[model samples]
Target: MHFVIERNRFVHDVQNVAKAVSSRTTIPILTGMKLVATNEGVTLTGSDSDISIETFIPVEEGDLQLVDIKQEGSIVLQARFFAEIVKKLPGEQIEISVLDQLSATIRSGASVFTLNGLDPEEYPRLPQLEEDLMFKLPQDMLKNIIRQTVFAVSTQETRPVLTGVNLEIENGELICTATDSRRLAMRTSTVERNDQELSFKNVVIPGKSLTELSRILEENDELIEIVVTENQILFKLGHTMFFSRLLDGKYPVTSSMIPTQSKTSFSVQTKSLLQTLERALLLSDGKNNVVTLKTLPDQQIEITSVSPEIGKVTEDLTTSEQEGEEMRISFNGKIVIDALKVIDSEKVNIMFTGAMSAFVLRPTDHKHYLHLFSPVRTY
Candidate 1:
């Protein structure tokens, strides 16, 4: 295989798929990136069993000429050294050629290096789903869903289902939820689904996969195509495609966990309360980083946090308008921060029945997302 590619263009595509490559793997070939140069363009693929990312660089895009292929073949080059060498090479273009024994020579400017590559056949084949259960949404929405909910997933491996976000698509509504028993983040979006396709349920996607997907997605003029199969999920973003393995077990039913009524509610400024807690967090211990919120009349909340030896801090946060039963609730400040970041509005409504039950918080203007945090068991 032989090809000439712009140095910067090659480096960009390499970094896109490098996120999928595994550093610690029993299969040595999985550590390298698979490069396929055909008549169409140059394709780079990286995989590590759970996720695979493929990006193609066309010969010409708009006014930029990316790659020119002389021979049609594929080769796998060591990802660790190849990425570094190409990035530091001083040149406007890079020339790459592979020999019969899978050895590659890369030349640019006055520097040239020979690196051993593996046969592309050794790389694992990516999953191809024939099902048409697909949906279309702006790249930003998909990226937001992953960032908001994936952080709440369980880090423990024992309950594998909790480590993934449960997704269900039905009647044009796509709901994503994640929980680790302590708190939960739920985002419901009205996504455009295929009119002739059937709806599905219990599609648990690993939180780790969504985290990587968020990195690949940017806030741009691009729409991402989502296709789900029985055991794999595919994301098509222009000339790039991403695949992730689905979880095998059933995700817990999270809807029943949300309460039907709240005994007390407070609609306050998200930034004011968030800033109050940020200062209070300084005195909180790593084990029990608890913050107390006391709702008062006239749209005010007294926020306080205390530690055994560190000290204590308190603040009175004012809001636009507050009307609900007054209550005092203690919760993990970290979970509150996570929930606040997801809300995209100026004011967030906080609702709770008591200190022992689940509490609900959501943005006032944006009601599509609800962030619920279970109150910490405080003495």
Candidate 2:
């Protein structure tokens, strides 16, 4: 196998594919990246069993040439070393050639290095799913959905299903939900499906996978194609393809858990509330990170936090609007700050059923996304 590729383009594709390669992979060959050169273009792939990413660089894009193929073949190279070498090479182009006995030579500018290559045949094959169930979403919108929910997924592995984000599609609407039992985040969006009759439920994707995918996705209006099956999900972004294995257990039913009505409701400036909670948390117990919110007269609310070793903090914030019964609620201030940071609107609406029940937070102008937080019992 021999080929010469533009240095910058090759570096970009390598870094993207390297996101899937893990050094702790049980399979020895899985740590290496597979590169295949064909008549059309050059393909790079990396995987660690649970997730796989493949990207292609065409021989030429319009008038600019990307890759020149001397011989059409394939090779697997150590991902860690190869990526570093390519990035630091002082050259406009890199030339790679595989020699006898699975040895490869890399040359650029005045630098030359030889790396022992693994046989590409030993690499695991990526799943191939029929495009029977496929839909499209704007790249920027998909990134927003991931950012809004993936953080709320449970880190504990005890309940494997809760460590993933649940995706459900029905009647042209797609809902994504994630929860750690203590808090939950949900987002809803309309999808363009290839089949109008297609619908699915309980398709839980690992939170880690979505986090990585978000990093690679550029914020733009380009549409990304999504294909879902029983056990795997594929995200097609132009010439790149990302694949992830679905969780095996059933996701807990969460619709009944969200409160339909609130006993106390108020709208407040999102930034002001976030900053107040951050300052209050500084004086609270680090372990609990609790902050107390008490409704006052004249549409004002009091925020306070106290610690035995430290002192106390109190501040009054005037709400834009307040209604229902006056109440006091204590919750983890860190969780509220996280939810507030993701909200895009200037003001946020917070609704509480009671002091002991879960409260909901959402943007004042949007009904498609919301965050629910379970209150803490403070003495």
Candidate 3:
């Protein structure tokens, strides 16, 4: 392969795909990135089984000449070295050419270097999903959905299904749920599809994939086309393509866990309550990191936490509105922080169900997202 490209453009494209590379990959060759030179442009691919990301840089991007191709070929370069070399190149232009079938040369400005590369044929092929079952979501909405739910996925591999976020499509609405038994995060968003469009259910996406997708997105409002199949899901954002392998087994029926009515629901300032808990968590660190909530009459609430060895901490938090009976609840400080970080509202509704049951937290502005936390007993 031979091509002359701009240093910055090359660096940006390489870095984007490199996000999929894993340092602990079982396959040695999978650690490298595949570089394919075609008549239209240069394509770069990186994968680590669970997720694969591909980026394309066309020769002519509108008026700019991004790549000039002299020969058409493909090769796999060490991702660690390739990324560093492209990013730190001294000049505006870069010339890359493959020699002796397994060696590659990259030159820019006053620097020239040659490195050993592997045959692209050794790389695994990306799985393809048909466009039959595809839907579109606003980039901002997709990013929000992933952020709101991915945090709740279990980090431990005790249950395979718990490490994935469950996705269900019905009636032009997409519902995403993530849980680890201790806490649950669910986010729903409307799609831009008509009744004629196809719908799917029980799609499981690994939490790691969703986290990488969130990072890859540049916080845009552009509509993204999502294509799904039995084994794989693809997210097409203009010229780039993101692919993730679906997890096996049925996701738990999370709808049944949500309560239609609550014993107590009150609106509390999101920032104020978050700040109060942040302070209380310091004292509760050694005491199971538990925070006690006492909801009183007249829109007043007391937040307290105590530890036998450490000093106690208490804070009075103000609320916007209160409903139902006054009740007290206790929650894990870590779980509360996880849910509160994603609640993007000025105020939030906290529901106290029972001493042994999970409590629901909802955003006051949007009814699309719900955070449930299983309280820890510290009495």
Give the top-scoring candidate (TM-score): 2
**TM-scores of the models, in the order given:** 0.96, 0.98, 0.96
Q: After superposition, which runs of candidate 2 have C-alpha atoms over 4 Å from their true positions?
A: none
- Candidate 2 versus truth, CA RMSD in Å, comes to 1.0
Better of 1 and 3 by lDDT: 3
For candidate 2, the TM-score is 0.98
User: Please, what is the whole-model Cα lDDT of each candidate in the order they appear?
Assistant: 0.87, 0.94, 0.87
Superposition error at 125 for model 3 (Å): 1.2
Model 1, backbone clash pairs (residues 3+ apart or across chains), number? 0
Q: Per-residue lDDT tens digits of candidate 1, residues 1-379?
A: 8999988878987888988888887799999999999977899999888999999999889998888899888899988788888889899999988987488999999999999999888788888788588888899989888888999999999999899999987778889999999999999888876664557889999999989888889987478888989899999999999999999898888899888797887678788778788888988777778999888777777988989787889888886556667788889998888788777889888888887899988889976788888887777
Clashing pairs in 2: none
Model 1: ten consecutive residues of lowest lDDT: 190-199
Window of ten residues with lowest summed lDDT in model 3: 192-201
Give each prediction's root-mean-square deviation over alpha carbons: 1.5, 1.0, 1.4
Ranking by lDDT: 2, 3, 1
Model 3 over residues 24-68: C-alpha lDDT tens digits? 898988889999999999999999988999999999988999999
